[model samples]
Target: MTETSKNLIAEYYALHLGELRAFVAKCTGSPADSEDMVQTIFLRLLQTDKMISAVTLPCLVYSAARNIVADYWRHRKSVERHETYVKSHCDCGTDSGPASVYAPAEIMQLLERGMARLSPKSRRIYTMSVVGGMRVSEISDTLGVAYKSVENRLGAARKEMRRYMSRMLA
Candidate 1:
């Protein structure tokens, strides 16, 4: 940037730092989060050339700060939601615990071998429904097959997995 642009941004920083920090604190409800968000806001502003536009400086700074605050809250909310979900779903031996417990590696190996034994169509449908976590309707749409065909494939895969598990254990 030219010296003129550099001087203009420096002026913006000097004039707005306290107001920005205060605004962030009000929006975020925590001093530390506000401080971090304000830093990010200023950093983003400095990295861009928008500071050179005389008419857009105030709007740009405000918009950037708002976006930063919004993103922080959005991310914070998602993390909190995920934590609650994990806590609610966690089963350490409770009645609501997981129905079956298989290590990921074991499950992967079992799935691989079981799928290998299935017919190609059955394997595709089963993988889409179970491993890929696709809905029956989604699989039907993706494979251009009827829902009944998908259901049959899923049943066959489940039966095959059961037999495969029995053989492995035996």
Candidate 2:
């Protein structure tokens, strides 16, 4: 980078750092993330040879920061949608209304019967995850078992429970 360009960027950074941070923080709702984004914008500006010289520096930086914030929101929304879908499918009790085929009480009975049918290890893992509210990794660590083993046990338990519930509902 040329000395003049470097100096111009430094000047811009000095002049607009606070404004950019405030604007980005407002957009992203996170002061820390906004600070990182502001640094990233300046870094991008420092790397490009001609773009900084071609456009108004403040305008370019603000525009890039806005784009970053927009992308953050878009990515957050996609993750939230995915998490909602996964929770709805993976958890049986997430839905229990008039449209539900089985009443909550019947579902609880089925769950209890199904849990009773699980092997000892599987039952413990399932209870720890679903009832004790422990994460799979935490259960694995607590049980001194491999992470994959805990996951497999949980998966098998869920499948068996689903089958039992389906049969009872039918």
Candidate 3:
């Protein structure tokens, strides 16, 4: 990378890290995912010579980040749609009526519907991990699965849930 680019990136990170993090978190719906996306954005910038030379470099980064976030949302939406289709095919059905959870009835209903959309195994894994507050090892033992399987399932479940929340809000 050029000295100018290094200086620019440093300046941007020093001055705008919090803002960028907040922006990415708002766009991506989670802090951890936003952190990953921001790292990816900067890495992409570092690798691209053309992008490094733009006069409006900061704006360009933000734009690119936005595009990335949009793409992420698109993929997430696709996953949710697939899950919904699978859910429809499965015996697990959603309740259109009021929910018993803490949120407003409508919001709770939507969350339940979204959770219902997940595969039965995924739903069980998620409930155990989140609601039951079980560790991966504990969940794996309880479910008679490996720790890695629990981790992978939980990761996918979290992504699906975030996507569901994003779609619900949007």
Candidate 3 residue lDDT tens string, 68-108: 89978987998799778645654434544334222467667
State the displacement of the C-alpha of residue 81, model 2, in Å, after optimal TM-score superposition. 1.3
lDDT of 1: 0.77
Reference-based lDDT, residue 79, model 3? 78
In angstroms, the error of model 3 at 80 is 0.3
lDDT of 1 at 108: 80
Q: What is the lDDT of candidate 3?
A: 0.80
Report the C-alpha lDDT of model 2 over 107-169, residue by residue, as the tens digit: 788889999999999999999988896779889989999999999999999899878866776
Candidates in order have lDDT scores of 0.77, 0.83, 0.80
Q: After superposition, how far is residue 134 of candidate 3 from its true place, in Å?
A: 31
lDDT of 1 by residue, 95-160 (tens): 544544446687688768878989988888888877686778789989999988888789878888
Summing lDDT over every window of 10 consecutive residues in candidate 1, give the lowest-scoring window: 92-101
Listed per candidate, the RMSD to the true structure in angstroms reads 12.3, 12.0, 11.7
| Model 2, runs deviating above 4 Å | 92-170
User: Which regions in candidate 1 have their CA more than 4 angstroms from the true location?
Assistant: 92-170
Name the candidate, 2 or 3, with the larger lDDT value: 2
